[model samples]
Target chain A: MIRFFTNVWNNFKEYIVLVILILASLIILSQNKSPQVQKVRAIAFGSFATFTSIISDMFSVTDLKRENQQLRERNAELMIQISKLRKYGIINEELKDLLGFKDTANVPLIPATIISRSLSMTQNMLTLNAGRKHGVLPGMPVVNDRGFIGIVHSVSEDFSIARTLNNVDLKLTVMDERSRINGIMKWTGEELVIINIPNTFDIKIGDRIVTSGISSIVPLPLPVGIVEEFRPSETSGFSYIKVKPFVDLKPIENVFIIAEVQSKQKKDLELNFYRRQSDEIR
Target chain B: MKFDKIFPFLIFFVGLLVQVTIIPLVSINGIVPDLILIMLVYYSITRGQLYGTVLGAYYGLSVDLITGSLLGSAMLSKTLAGFIAGYFSTETKRDINISTFNFSMIVFLCSMIDTLIFSFFSAFDFNTNFVTVLFEHALLPSLYTGVVSILFIFSPFRRKRLL
Candidate 1:
């Protein structure tokens, strides 16, 4: 019996690490009730993902070449549209003035290369080449030539992580560029969709969607995407709309991070008004 | 312990670099093979359960760092896989090639576990339906990982190094 106990002890030392790891997992699972713990968990996971993405980007040089060729071709097609828009500059200017617009604001776009993409099964995150050095910060909006991509969530010294609109975690205040009906855009996991718009909202397929600038994270009137499909929710009073994301993230290379753009004072004013109203009732 | 201890880490790092670099070029719809799982299986079969468990935990940590999923998520799945795979280690016949068949099964199982854990966490985070998690990302990618393992058996890594 003594020899048997000794043998078990000898073998126990070999698998001790695995036993400890399993125990740690159980502890985390049990202690994850606090929202603060969950936030830390999310941050840790995000950092880990950002690190892996950077390492992977170091090896994506060859793949980036092929992606660059595609982007260049797309860039040429966009230039034609830019030229046509330039031709109608007078009419656009008049329209902008009528709609209460700012003068031609020189919003300097800090462009960066795509460092790494999330191949993970959960969230859709993309790492950008720009970081704190380039004035990129959390909550800053990112875009491509097509439209709104996502918002930066985390920043390292040399890279920033953008949580694409494909992520279900993001909620953007958006409206149909044609109909003026506003809604919140969110990813539905299976498809990019919008919520909070009433069924009677005047939205249609192919109607261009743009940011309402209500959210401090994004500038007003930025292109979001086009409405693809719409249907009334089965169990709700609101309608659901599917949006095909304007930014084709799969072939992403260079993206522009918009900083020093959003008007935070407007957001603060709205928040204060709401708080005051609520306080008066209380 | 010298070669046994150091070899898996070496293979783990190599697998990680290759997974990031080489596998992306070969995937369809950005799904790459699970190279770390294959290495875990390979070593688990050669070494005993204890060795398998240790390497599995080490490999899982590396995978968690490299893949960017939840922190202990890969560790839990991989340690379980290593323990389970190690149970069948001493039973296999020595002369026969276990790489091909063993590699396929491990890829299938580990991919399923990895995907399921990720999707489960995603659903918790995003409030998406469970079905979407299973159908959207899990099914096809796991199949692709399995197919890649079959091809990996024929690659020079298997032939030249006799690994």
Candidate 2:
């Protein structure tokens, strides 16, 4: 029996190890959402991001001249837009006062620079220099001058990771600015697509898409993308809408984190309503 | 020999550093070469299969944790890739494999499998177009990694000399 066992071990040891590691990986995959795993992941990435930020800082210096020029141009553009918006703001405040509407413009923005990026077809992620120490938190939206970039996924002491719009795992509720129609938008590995819109919907090519106010992840509306293509399914009544994002994530360096999550009051109200409905059913 | 055993891990860290920091700058249409896979293939050819398999798991898990990819996706793909690459590690042809164009070919093959398995775990669905996924996620990245591996053949410090 010992000799037989030794022969099997010598001949198939590689296969045995491979199977063991494969099983270990699957177990880890299943534990991805556990708090302990999340803690370990946060620590691991936090330590690595410190080293990566140094390398990123060295490379960013070479692009400073070009970035400076672009920022100057963008500043001028925003100056003109802000002047125009100020006129509307005064009238809007007076109208809001008359209607007794609550102000929602007090959201804070935290500035940060992209320290590194993990570029993949389906899992594109960005590491930023802001984290818990900087008041950055998961689920906050990261934006640039162009528009929305991504949502913060994880945070540590000095760094945070963001899931970009190109990542397959992120799904968002977006609306058409012109038509006021809402749809679920996601990265399809090949493109950004708004799925399950009926063919009769009023969406058209070149319509601007923005985050919907109804979305739990991002309650405030923000520019997302523009509809690039609208194809109706041949067999089904649904249409497929492709979006071209305003922000070209590859070249972006600095971004602002909109330091907000869904309001707790709203969440609690919704939860209470659901509880009442379930109680009635019971 | 001790230095040689520890050397691949050091290369993995440097490769990972370049992957996350510098590789994005050179990305073509959001597709970049897998620098870690190329290094894994190189070391698997030099080392034995068991060593390659274990290293692949370590490298893949680290990438998943740090890069925010699905935790086990890369781990599974890279382990299989390392095992396949180790098949070419026979003593008789090991030198010939590293010194010649064959190294690039092996890298290409292993990279394709690596990317395919990784994509399967992360992105595959019934509605997806298999051909497009194969072309974009598997082929392009593997070709890029393979082309980059050609540099190893011509490095100033050649195989066995560097270690």
Question: Where in model 2 is the C-alpha error above 4 Å?
Answer: A62-99, B160-163
lDDT of 2 by residue, B37-142 (tens): 9888878888989999999999999999999999988999899999999999999998888889999999999999999999997678767899988999999999
When summed lDDT is taken over every stretch of 10 residues in candidate 1 chain A, the lowest stretch is A79-88
Q: Write the per-residue lDDT of candidate 1 for residues B35-63, one digit (tens) a residue.
A: 77777766776676777777777776555
Over the stretch A1-282, how does candidate 1's per-residue lDDT look in tens digits? Answer: 999978877878546756786787556545545566545544544455454555655655767666774675465336324533533352476787699865433455667666555556346677676777899877888877776788887666666777888776678898776776778888766677787788877888998777774556676356777899989866777887898877776766677776755666867788899999999999
| Total clashing pairs for each candidate | 0, 0
lDDT of 2 by residue, A1-282 (tens): 999989999999999999999999999989999989889999999999999999988876656745764684464345324433443354466786799866554557777788888858888899999999999989998877667788999999999999999998999998887787999999889889999899999999999788887898987667788999999887889998999998888888788787888889999999999999999999
Model 1: lDDT of residue B123: 43
Question: What is the CA-based DockQ of model 1?
Answer: 0.37
Q: What is the C-alpha RMSD of each candidate to the true structure, in Å?
A: 5.5, 3.2
Fnat, model by model in order, equals 0.26, 0.74
Best by lDDT: 2
C-alpha positional error of residue B42 in candidate 2 after TM-score superposition, expressed in Å: 0.8
